[model samples]
Target: MIKPSSPTPDHLRELKFSCLDQFIGPFHYTNLIFFYQADAAAADDDENGYKSQALKQSLSEILTVFYPLAGQVVLEGNSSINCNDNGVAFVEAKVLDGRQLSDMIEEPNLEELKHFLPTQHFVVEDNIVLLLQVSFFDCGGIAVGFSFLHKVGDGKSMGEFMTAWANANKYKCNKCKCRCDDQFMNNFNLASLFPPVEFLRTTSLPSTTNLSEKFVTKRLILDRKKLTDLKEAIVSAPGSQLKDPTRVEAASAFIWKHYIIDSAAQKRRQIKLQPNVDQVEVVVENAFMAQHTVDARTRMNPPETNVFGNCFLIAATEIVNYNDQQQEMHHLAYLLRKAIKKIDGDYIKQVQIEGERYFTNLFQRLDPVLKGKLGLCSFSSWCRLPFYEVDYGWGKPLWVCTTPIPLKNLVVFISTPSGDGIEAWINMLEDDMKIIRIE
Candidate 1:
């Protein structure tokens, strides 16, 4: 356990989670893995030990600032945490077999990749808000992984926390102590904007934890040329809403099209198997939905980025019945773009005006999917997130990866080191994996 280097101030002793945070639940964790390859020859155990010590010491310093991470959540109310400097979980692992980072990550299996991260299951009582692990490879490559409780924050908060950790390492001095300026600080003003409430407790969020079907997470990488081609193809579609298509839009649409095609295939097979049904190939045109979490920070500047909690709202695409092959991926991309566009300044105000009711209404929209009345898929993009900016004197990571996500029908987009390529990890049923593999 890595406690704060010092005790938290009395004034900042209690920190409340936002309504959105409560709704997100502590059952889930936001996981990230950063792999770094040294420029010179592989460092020995002594050298790696020194590096780990540096990281541990720096982590202690940052906990004093990002104190919520070191605190315990009250499971009863599920509202606030006691900032008592209880500390975080930190682990260091060495590959038992003589394996290098490059070999391990070359063709990453999501389940195998998860081993590098911490906290596969959350122990509710402990309320250890954050857990970090440092995995050492035989060839000096290091993988820094973390498991952050979802209720504490979202992707934006996790990104900023990483930045804070990196800064703490960069700004620290062994000789003397110095107070960092406001630029290095973060605000917890979200509680004021979206205060803690018991009303939202009844509202249910989508979960796949109890799923009967075996789920698998697969990563699909689109290189620069492939991504560019996809964008061009999407833009070239006649009557497409897209003037210029983004990687997320193009990729989302591409996956959506496949899903629709697969749905049609599934329908045809069912029809053939049914006793009374006509044995004919059925081309099913189903209404599907797309959901994405849009960070409010993306629409803000400066200080806004530093204000964290669950600072994001869901962007749900319009009900889509995609049967037209000529429309291609453009239609779905347009729908996604439209949904995301609604998350503007006006929408932010609506969230304020409607308060927590807005979130309730937004989640209620997914009732159809929750009831199995609508086809659904969720997308979360970390392409331009601060995961790329993490530098602790040794320099930025060589690669950034996510752990196994149990949520079925979810696509997580991470950016390649080049920033031009996209690595999309899709979590779906084991049977669906065959369909995905073919595509």
Candidate 2:
């Protein structure tokens, strides 16, 4: 049994405030996908009762254990959603059949799901949806999937909380010993940094028109051999001086270029809204090559390392310009590479200091033609994530997927699969998906 720490005194309130602020975001979204196998005997034994009772019981215990940490989850910056005034809104449901789960999981319908979720304008109250889907296989095992919002917390923080909750549930049933320490929760305060406010505005406001477009999710598996060959080609190129860029970096660049070229091509094919508007503007932005290192104070150099929560800031490689003529795929790819390289650690730090200034200047000198019609902008490739480490004693998941969540325009992610190479999942408009190039 893990020992409990002394109760945190009221004087040390800043710690709690900092913890809450750290998790909240002005412009951030995150989701969690959980896969589980049901126990057949348990289902058969509880024929009269709901088979999912055990799972619900487990979830209840986990939430109780995390009650203290719940306050830490809050909103930062400017957000239309009022999380403080409205408590955590979680939705729970099960997938009756595997086919149903497969259909929704295959190509994510982001716009449809967004509509179903509680929005600020739709209702007087605000809430977050926690979608739970359960499928029973012929073999008697059950699979559970969780789709969570990132506004609450990042993947790392979500995993830690889930682990603690699972461990607590296991201890209740005497299946395993509880090793969770109260010190983890005692050191932080939950209600200081961002006091409940009436209204908050987003840095970039949403479009006035309703999003009528449909969305689709597709997967592209790049095996080890093929990935190796692609990397070799990139490295062997005469001018390519990045001695060794990882497969993730190279693939991200390749995919990004394909999309940009296709976007530009689609623009050329479109009919002008007006005769004066001859040039089309395309903007491609992504969080590639953005690395956030741990602070010195937080790192345990010699003995231990605290790898809990997401201790990183988000940065993006953005491209904004007007094109009167179509550009070649290769040229677009090269420009993306150059833009990504320009924001190294030093550049990022400088941007961090003067980022607001730069944006302010740009907005002040905004172009008349490019005032409102900006196409889909995105960020992808969530590499080096610790998702697999979230083992709730049932071993790692066979496959984990996150989809149907909307960003400003779109957001794509690629992560290592338990069995092989990488799995690519995108949350985009149906029209945007048509132009996406995997090659």
Candidate 3:
């Protein structure tokens, strides 16, 4: 890993953490990789070397404003960043065996994509807050991979940091007189809003770890037309009161339904194998729920989207029955709408009032999933986020994608560069993926 060109300023040491930061539960790095086609002329002109130096230099400047990222998270007194200006881990790699970027994009594979990320797994150690890798391909294509602790911030914060760094690189902010640090002050004073609960300090939250060999990740694209068609079908269906289900709701409902179908089918297969079991007594238990991620920025009275900490929460719907296809789709979408709608201003106030009790109950709800009795489909929407806006003086990325997530039944939605479609990056069991592909 390449270290920062210069050490962090001594005055910026000891970054403080808000209660919102502690709510992130565990230390896990969110990953993404942006791809760019190889520049033919630059291939012979040593542009890759130039690009690497530019990124490192710009990152050093960006760290001054985002000082917390440059340091490590420590548990002194409470959980906060040491901000010692140690520096972030940055590295460069090459696509092995002359593989081109298109080869991986055309037929996306989680196993191959994992190689692009700097980490061997999702675990964040050594006080490392961020990990970045710039990979070069034989065809001159470059894939910029980024992995950062979710505790640092949510997708919105990540997008903001990326844009700021890119701008610093493109414009050389040292020449500009404007103070950029003022722009990154949203993360301050979050503790007053969501006070840290003592229970969080006493008990560790449960985390699920699925076998990598047993899981597979796939990318499913739904264009505007397709989403419109799905929404229309939902509205036109029998007993439908919905006017227009959003792209995220529709896609999530559709994908969740497919997961249920595949799961139930697998249960049936297992039942058939047991010849001694009574068919009538053999109950195929199927319970599913959606953990829809909601950004707390707009939910607050004054709007805190600019806040730097993890200002996001999960709004989970009630258990959705796996019934007929069309019926389930509409029901899931309606439940999702209701759940998300409840997360407005009042909800934020309630959370602040409830505090520890609220967080404890939220943690308890995952017990079923932790015990392998329930299926939780976690969906995070990055559709409206400005991930594609990071220019870095090389033009916007040709394609922005993420690697396979470590969790099962986790799906992330990204907006296509054209802003006309949603790309669902889904992670599931290998058997379930086979069923999804076949159906």
Candidate 4:
């Protein structure tokens, strides 16, 4: 375990989770891995003691600001954090005997990458909010993997904490006061605005960990030209409602289209034994839904992107008539855009006013799909997130990616270093992925 180099100060201890935090509950952890080429400048020792020390010291200092990360998540009394500075689980691992970095990551094996992550395997204890693992490869390359419980933070929150830590390391400010804490506190007022409800206590976030299905994760890179063509096609396609769509909208539309096509074929194959029900009609009737987790920091009134915690919600759009012959890419993009637009300041305010009722209605609609009644496709785009900006005193990471997600029909998009393209880390059933890869 990686303990803090110095003990946490008593004054900056307990941290509370906001009502938004209660929405997601405490089951999932978001994982990220960064790879760096070994620094040629520091070749003194094989252990790379200097780099490790810098990382540990900077992390300990930053814990003072991002204090809740080091503490445990408490489910009792409305679910808050006891920021006692217990420290994060830090691990050091060596790459396989004969493997080089290229060999390991050329076509990433998600299960193998999980070995480099802290904890036994995505286990979240009550007190552990953050865990990190640093792996040293024989080729002088290093992989840094870390995960934080979703209860205390979201992608934005994690990115902020990482950026702060990197800043501390780059400047050699072991005791630097962080401005991020101020931004983190700004989100506290939102708690009163959007208070918790009784329904949340009874509602359980659906777990989609299906052991029967074989899951696989694969990387799909959309370079500048491909992305541009997609956007152009989405905007110009028949039934197109949008004049100019964002890159994410274009990519989502493309992926959703292909996913629906594959699902339709899969449905056809499954219903060959049952001739009574029309498979085409069934496919059209039960179209897969696309849900995107939208970060509302900028969407909120007075627009605050600097705040911390789970300041986001899922915006879902339905896809009907999956087997339609027409070009539905534009329509898909339109539907996604419409759903995202609904998550405006007024919608947030309505949730604040109708907190319990809002969540109750939400659960009623969501609980069914979580129980495997329907096919759901989820996306979380980290294209705008500054994950690559993390320097950590050793220079920028050569590659940043995520491990295999446990659930299927999920895609997480991250920006390439060039900032012109997006890397989609897609997870789905093995057979489905094989079909998807061909598409």
Q: Pick the candidate with the highest lDDT.
A: 3
TM-score of each: 0.91, 0.64, 0.90, 0.90
The runs of at least 3 residues in candidate 1 whose Cα sits more than 4 Å from the true structure, single-residue gaps closed, are 39-42, 122-125, 171-181, 184-186, 202-204, 275-285, 300-303, 325-327, 437-439
Q: Which stretches of candidate 3 lie above 4 Å from their native place?
A: 1-12, 75-78, 174-179, 211-213, 272-284, 325-327, 437-439
Which portions of model 4 miss their true places by more than 4 Å? 2-14, 40-47, 76-78, 96-98, 104-107, 174-190, 211-213, 278-285, 323-327, 371-373, 434-439
**Tens digits of per-residue lDDT for model 4 on 146-209?**
7888878888888888888777777776343445445455443445555666656545455566
Q: Lowest lDDT 10-mer window, candidate 1? A: 277-286
Model 2 spans with C-alpha error above 4 angstroms: 1-30, 38-61, 68-138, 170-178, 182-210, 271-311, 318-376, 414-416
CA lDDT of each candidate?
A: 0.76, 0.43, 0.77, 0.74
User: Looking at model 4, which ten-residue stretch has the lowest summed lDDT?
Assistant: 174-183
Each model's Cα RMSD: 3.2, 7.2, 2.9, 2.9
Please state the error at residue 192 of candidate 3 in Å: 3.5
Clashing pairs in 1: none
Screening candidate 4 with a backbone cut-off below 3 angstroms (N, C-alpha, C), the clashing residue pairs are: 72-127
Model 1 RMSD in angstroms: 3.2
Cα lDDT tens digits, model 2, 1-439, are 1111233234431222222233333333354455544444544434413545444555554443344332223244432222121123333343343433334445545343332232323211223323344444433444444544444444555556666655654455342456555524442222221222222223432232233556466656677776677667667765655556566655555565556567666665563444454342323221112121222112222211233333333333344443432223233334445555554555534433554443444333323213445343445455455565545455555456554544333444546554346665555566777886664
Top candidate by TM-score: 1
Ranking, TM-score, top scorer first: 1, 3, 4, 2
